[model samples]
Target: MIIILLILSVIIGVFLGKYFGKSQSFAKNLLILSAGFLITVCVSEVFPEVYEAEDHNIGIWIIGGVLLQMILESLTKGFEHGHFHHHHEEKNILPIALMAGMFVHAFLEGIPLANITDVTSPYLLGIVFHNLPISFILGTFLLREKNNIFSWFIITLFALASPLGMVFGDYFNPEWQPYFLALVGGIFLHISSVIIFESNKNHKMDWQKLFLVIAGVGLALVNHLFHAHH
Candidate 1:
């Protein structure tokens, strides 16, 4: 289901970008909210689970993941935080470096899902939903750069990255799940924090964006509660 949803998200994103022109404002708000959702899931679910191991001191690994994302952003140029710098009039060549960074992040995020107790889980939902806005971002970027077979090829590769990570992770040892979860938690922490903080210029807060962020956090909380009861 998770893999299916991820692929569907890519298709939906392509449709959206095709019918509608570039949606910068909508994409920005979506990015903000997506960041909020990710942070909430990391705090409310992932952190607690990874910290459960008695012998596992995952602090270093978490920090390492954070640093890794920082380096990735250097290559992606903050696309993970919805900072799409390219305009429609830019060159028609693909941004291989940026996509490479995003693929790495998406792939790593799927690792823990393969070993999760609840196959249908909030973490899975968080990742799927989080990818929603990202898919839009990718669609816009790719279509603008190369609206051809090459662009679809890149998009297909992006869609497959997480599912491929799940396949790899399923064969990985179960004992390592906690450490990988912590690493992913740290990666989420970094991405979400960047989206929230670096979004508005001059630190000016828009009330609508603020409300969206709040709504994102609220939705995650409700999802967590609902899952806990079930």
Candidate 2:
């Protein structure tokens, strides 16, 4: 079931990428929605469980994951945004490196999803939903750069990274699960915060975008309520 969910997520990501690659506004809105949903998942769901587990030592893992992501992002110089227009010759090395970093993050996230006993459904749903927008944004960048084959390949690979993590998590003992969740939660928190901060309009406030964010949170809240009722 988990594997099937992951596969469905990848397919949905591909379809969303292909569909939204044309509209910058739609893409931006999708990203905002994804950011809100991800934040809710991390804060309302994942963090609570980690805290309940009483693993203060996991803070080290979270900090390490955040620092690792910072270093990786520094190497890419924000290429994940796909706005680079340098006349200097483009090399595939940096892009490949960025993908590797993302893959590591995604793979780690999958571990917790696989090990989840109580929160499995919502966690998996959040992951699948959140990944779709990321895939779309990355796809948009690739399309703009005119790298069709590489774009598809990277998107597909990103989709698979989580499931691979699940496989690892399934094989591993339960004792290490808290550390894994903390690490991935930290990474997700970092990524979602960056997206929200970057998406802020510097010159003026965008009410529509704000509303979209609220809508995203509302959706998650509603889902949470439904799950609770069930």
Show where candidate 1 strays beyond 4 Å: 87-94, 117-120
Global local distance difference test of model 1: 0.80
TM-score for each model: 0.91, 0.83
Candidate 2: list runs displaced more than 4 Å: 75-93, 117-120, 143-151
lDDT per residue, candidate 2, 151-175, as tens digits? 7787777878988898888888887
What C-alpha lDDT values do all the predictions have? 0.80, 0.69
Weakest 10 consecutive residues of candidate 1 by summed lDDT = 85-94
User: What's model 1's lDDT at 2?
Assistant: 70
Q: After superposition, how far is residue 167 of candidate 1 from its true place, in Å?
A: 0.6
Candidate 2: residue 123 Cα off by (Å): 1.8
Backbone clash tally for model 1?
A: 0
Local accuracy of candidate 1 as per-residue lDDT tens digits, 20-139: 536688888887888888899999999888888754668788898899999888877776777665633554334687668878988998888788656448788778777877778778
Return the TM-score for candidate 2, rounded to 2 decimals: 0.83
* Best candidate according to TM-score: 1
